[model samples]
Target: MTERSNQSVRRAFKLVDELAENGPRGVSELADQLDMPVSTVHDYLQALIATGYVTKDESAYKTTTRFLEVGHRQCHRLEVFKAVRDELETVAEETGEHATLLIEEDDQAVIVAVQEGPDAINLFAYPGARMPLHATAPGKAMLAHMPTERVTDIIDRHGLVEVTPQTVTDPDVLFDQLEDVRSQGYAIDVGERIAGMVCIAAPILDKNDRIRGAICVCGPRSRLDEDRRSEIADVAQRAANVTQVNLDYV
Candidate 1:
């Protein structure tokens, strides 16, 4: 945790980021793009290689397969999503809405799985779809449980553009909403991200009780207004708990 060590790691990460976007590159190319000394870049690259985060091929350095494997493991080993599939199906069968799972990646919420509810309504989410962290219900639920530094970084990168009349575009308000989510144990999007769509979501906690992912139910706004929001929240929370229990076995 020393300043010097942190700086070195940061520099190494920057080099990796450059290589990631620019494809494989030689030490000189990385140094030039990062504006760091060639020797320094080489040292960091070597360190990355040692940690299996990067691999050197003759003259070019690229990200290692290990990083890919690690990401893959994290995605699949997500306990909450794994645990709640059957329950989500049941919830969908009973409610006839769409049930979904979302996970945070690079400060954005990505849909990992979805189940169609019995109501037979059309919905926007599917696996691999990305949504703004500040706009979607699952996005806000995940963000509400993340570290402040991580949340601030995302806000700094992607400004809170108003996606709908209900979207909170102010950071202060978003922060306050996060607090409310923490207290209430879930988040609701009543047509905040998409017009005429209502979403209710709850955080999926891991074995460590950390926010690992989120489970949600979505349907037409007409069916999930303020009067029925509590009912939707109840379903979401139950599904989330089921997902958490599943993660324990995984």
Candidate 2:
């Protein structure tokens, strides 16, 4: 590809992704993230704005609602996304906690869909958030369901890095926890990803019993206490099953 063709699309996508993750940003910030000159980023933003994909607000630029309009159309066309969305919403409604769908991607766990519950606590993972496979409840659930070789590949690629004080960083401990997830049919994250937050996750398995993805319910520790742990877990498991069934996974 020529410089003009490759540079514009690549830089535009970087700006769009950065904006998607952290709202409107200044040209300098976008330039710094893309490792390009501010003038270059500003030029790209001008092109994007002209095309109606991005908008400018004084000194900052943000992706326009055009992306949302396209996203709504795309979501309907993606069968797996359509299949799990209802169950994800149901889990959030039933548990009164954040419900999310996560799938392993490029050796990382990718948050693909989410629904927030009535109460809001701070676990900043949103749709398109990429997290370490060994550092999250949904990641562990899906990992436990995967074949041993694939599990090892993921662990090898993304080591058990600590995200919080309670995060299991030791390889041995993480392996043991994976074993427990296999036996228990659910995975738990007690302040593992974020302090004072608890998460329960269950894997949606395919017809071959391979993990397709996982469903998770998250909330503050006080709300997701021992008294309601099983209840939340059961709801998450049922949601996962619902997704599998929708996919025609026997």
lDDT of 2 by residue, 1-250 (tens): 8999897788789888999879999999988877999898989889999999999998889999898777567556655676798898889888888888888878788877889878756577666678887888998998887778887776677677888888888878888999999898899998888788888999888766878888988898887778799999999888888888888832
TM-score of 2: 0.83
Question: 191-218 in candidate 1: lDDT tens per residue?
Answer: 8988888888999887777888888888
Clash count for each candidate, listed in order shown: 2, 0
TM-score of each: 0.68, 0.83
**Predictions: Cα RMSD each:** 6.8, 2.9
Segments in model 2 whose C-alpha atoms lie over 4 Å from true places? 1-9, 32-35, 118-125
Candidate 2 residue-wise lDDT at 74 = 59
Candidate 1 has an lDDT of: 0.83
Where's the lowest-lDDT run of ten residues in candidate 1? 71-80
